[model samples]
Target: MQPTLTGRRIIQPPRSLLVRVRESVDFLARHSPARFAILVFTALILVWTLLLSLPISSHARSGTPLADALFTAVSVICVTGLSTVDMATHWSGFGNALIFIGVNIGGVGVLTLASILGLVVSRRLSLRARLMAASDSNASRIQAGPVNEGQAVRLGEVGNLLATVAFSALAIELIAAVVLLPRMLAHGYDLGHAVWYSFYYAAMAFTNTGFTPNAAGLTPFVHDYLFLGALMFAVIAGAIGFPVIFALVRLWRQPRRWSVHVKLTLFTFAVLLVAGTIMYIWLEFDNPRTFGDQNAFDTVFQSFFMSVMTRSGGFSTIDISDLHSSSLLVTDMLMFIGGGSASTAGGIKVTTLAVLFLAAFAEARGRTSMEAFGRRIPRDILRLAVSVVLWGATTVAVSSILLLHITKQSLDIVLFDVISAFATCGLSTGLTQDLPDSGVYVLAATMFMGRVGTVTLAAALAASTSRQLFRRPEERPIVG
Candidate 1:
């Protein structure tokens, strides 16, 4: 009996290991939200690299370099879309698949999805993840229901958040693909390729990734009524966050209660979009390569799309490199101002822009309290706005300096590339491919910064230390 019992115990190795794994998974699910996010992003890049490295990706003739894989993965996962290798020429069918996957994963935070699954099994969100999610989503409060005002979200709520993002992504991307299909198919592609192109471009465009699989993305479809409409539709939807989406839905339901953020985002977005369109049109009026021969409608349409793509989405109706110098500067400026918070787009965000602009306006008017659309802007928000602009300028300054040193290229191109990377804009002037190794490194760093975000990185560093606790009382002396 003793021998039989011992043998049975020894025979339970598989079960023991299984239990161990379950416990380990549970532990991971309950702790380390930021690290968990990093791991997920890393895994996604690996999957992308593997797919692109497959025989099918190379047309069964080997695949891209390891450096290329890592670079592409970083770009795609970050939604920067700055490719060292040409997407149209270098990657194959299988490779393009990986690129789109990266775009989707990056555009919508990966943690948003994983958090949903964890909720199903564990019924609790890790404290770290909850904080990060709250931060990333830019919500004043994460959970909608009552709780200990001191307490954060439950595991199930995290799932709800994830479901909300995923479902929104799917709905928008699918509709975009459908809208793109007919016009895209009519442009010269067969049914299969057109479908593939539509889905690829839809995912990339919807995610605001500038990566292109076809030779011409929105260029050929420049004036096509449906195509241009679809491109704008997908990209704009993405630039606006999901929370804003929910808020808008409720507003649609009731027509009276739009949140401050939603109101600000819409107003800022409209102003910028209109401003950018007109700026580009004026800048490109006679640019030979861009819109010289085009009629008024085509010129305006292309300019509008170009303006839209510069911020977050990256579909281009003309060769970005061929744009006139003035137009390039305009795009660089637009890209620096990127998309709204918690959306696929990047940058300091439109909300930040709105708040900053309001703060400026208040200062200009010599008012003590900042107000926007009759809403009182909080002091905390003002502080954040200051920090964002300071840090953003600092980052750009540093990147521009490094870029200037690394490449002998024009300062305009370097600044454009740096801002593109920092804002996660991915609009380039063909210099990304021609860049030297050092230049590549600089751009790569910017991509990482853009993806993980200036705020995330700052928070990670702050959370890792207690040094701020002992700091001397602050004093300020400034002049401008």
Candidate 2:
């Protein structure tokens, strides 16, 4: 039998003061997982915000403007595409590189990296043992699933999670760069400019932030395949949650078998994308500003891209502001939905909405099982899905009320803006530039909240683990 820690090892606390305090807090919690995720994100963002706000280099021509730096840094770290500053003109290469590092770190998440490292070090096997190790250890990226449908949802074994995140990001980014290279070369950019453009586009696309190193972005190459190709791939990849991507990859290797998560995510994503695309095409057919000049094929392409971009990936072929009301409204809905859970894209998340729909359908049919992807949606998952939706919507509504008070904007415009910030969607109705610092900070905070999620943030603040479901003790209820 394997020996378990029974003495000083079991009783000992973390050596570092910070860790010790954290451990004491964690010990008090019934569920530490959610709290831990939130804490990791909050702490990282805090450190990143500080680093960007400070001027590190002595030879800099001007000290980084605090607002611009903070805003840019937050955008990168949250992987939110919104930007207050012109990245190309304002920051030096050093600053841009720092921002890129923040983007890479934030896009994938710190906890994910730590989880990868933990998985490597522990030398663990057996699904249950691995999950316990992964979940209990802050380093474990995210405990994923209960493979068996009837069983309690266990934290998913890390499996290909790490490899899929790392390699898939790189491979896609590299391919995008390659696709963009020819057009960049043809666009009168010198060898240096071409290479730099490739690198820059790759970074911007992968991060799903619309910050462009080139002043023109893909606008200069609106008709060019190379430029469009990179943007197209990047946004699509970003829009498709990481979990689905990895799951799809695993399914490809084992063609006959696909996990429940993989099947559902892919199914839900396809339906949303196709539906969003059709809506855009239909809504914008009579409207000229969005896709009026383009031919049918090009129009379809542009609409598709815009639809995809709405859900957290911020790149757009045409200036998003030009879109007609109907198109913008559809895009807003897409943004509100966001991407899948355990994925890079933000908003309320696709999975939450998916599970919700499943639950609702089950209720309507008077069926006890919430069927999705031929698998019964577990009660725990359904509860989490509901919590995510409820918390996200409430937060967005409150944030919107405050933002409208400050901006004095129309309800439609303010709602769009608030949703954009909270979803980290970055599809603005052009209010970002005119906002006061307080307003900007409010939006920025919303973006941060959107990125890490409200539940996780609340858990971190309270130092309590969160469960998807719990029993309620009976009490006298107040009447409405």
Candidate 3:
């Protein structure tokens, strides 16, 4: 019996620490999903680090160095393909399996994964959980104000969206595996090896993680057009974001019914794809180490492939370091822009670029509003886009400076790898493999911030926002 004041005695049961901890987690999941997501991703990285550090996970059957294990875990969990170790030979089958699992989980997204876990535990999505999941699809949902329904996933459709995420990933990977199976067999892999490699490559492609299992990397199949085509398709599917996929699936024939987010993402993605392809072909055409040795058709095809890979696919047929300096600059720009929002790919996202361009167009036209696809884009969105770009640029700049100082590497190479890490693009100029442990940790931090996203990180760090009852007088500052 427990003591009671001015009443009958009351009995209270003791609660275990585990229950208290779970309750606290649930509270965080309900109230502050962004912070919860950060915690979840951090926990996941630590778990993977421990797993990869195990003696059994390595080919040498000895524990991996802390720096390498931690960095690999970060890269895998972020779905970034950059690695300090020789990814193909350093890991045992168990280690590779852990990587495969980690990438898929990471690719699902932190908030969406949290919502899924909550749904599984409660047998349904609570409103807060729906909001958390919806925020993943449309980031504006995380803002303080009311979100425009036209551009966002509605609460009612969250379940279907979750199902779409899971189902589409499985279906796309299955198709890719089937298409790649024969190619693997043709390459002389045994049936079991063919099956495993087929599925592994399929997962890697769809997750936009460029880790290759074999020692030869993509060298063996550089000329395998069918295999490469399958990979390209999967990468595009992944980088387009699940929201776009959901919208496309439901409104494939109804273009007019498409949300502005979907329209902007697709249109910008196409423009960037073509632009990157042309730039690569123009810049690298005569470079002996890249396009010069290839015939006209192969050159164009490889240019297109590189264009896709730089969109955070992380796959490359040719040596990235051999590309011309100007080509590297172009790749840097493409990687900085990266792929679609809420997609497996990283960087500031193509949608952010589209918004900035639209705002510039509006300003040039002397219009007060940014209009796209017959709809007006909000001012807050423009602000958010600017913030994201600035944050991303700052992150890349700081990391580049730190890496340059740490490794004493050339600016071009350091900047390229830093942008690659920040964009999770995974394309490297042969610099990452030589980085010291400190440099590895810096790049790891860059990858984590890139994957968690600038917006999400900012939101997570913010303690709370206070609403004001009155407005302050507006002031104008001189323009640049």
* lDDT of each candidate versus the true structure: 0.74, 0.70, 0.90
Which ranges of candidate 1 are over 4 A from the true structure?
1-36, 50-56, 119-132, 139-160, 464-476
Which residue pairs collide, candidate 1? none
Pairs of colliding residues, candidate 2: 31-465, 32-465, 115-139, 144-156, 145-156, 339-350
Relative to the unseen true structure, what is the C-alpha lDDT of residue 334 in candidate 1, on a scale of 0 to 100? 84
Model 2 lDDT tens row, 1-480: 344587656544437788788777555332455565566666776766666666551125466656666666677788887877666766666667777777777777665665556557775444533443344322112323343443212346354666566788788878888888887888889988898778777767776766777877767877775577667678778666665676577567873466566666667877898999999888886667667767998888877777777877777777666777767778878888887655667887666677788888998899988886566666776766677678788878888888889988877787887788788777677787677887788888888888877556654565323466878788997955
- In angstroms, give how far residue 203 of model 3 lies from its true place: 0.9
Off by over 4 Å in 2: 1-33, 54-60, 117-156, 253-256, 461-480
Encode model 1's per-residue lDDT on 126-191: one tens digit a residue: 665565565456633321223322112233345456666777899988999998888777888899
Give the candidate order by descending lDDT.
3, 1, 2
Candidate 2: C-alpha lDDT: 0.70
Q: What is the lDDT of residue 17 in candidate 1?
A: 75
What's each prediction's TM-score? 0.85, 0.83, 0.97
Candidate 1 Cα RMSD (Å): 5.1
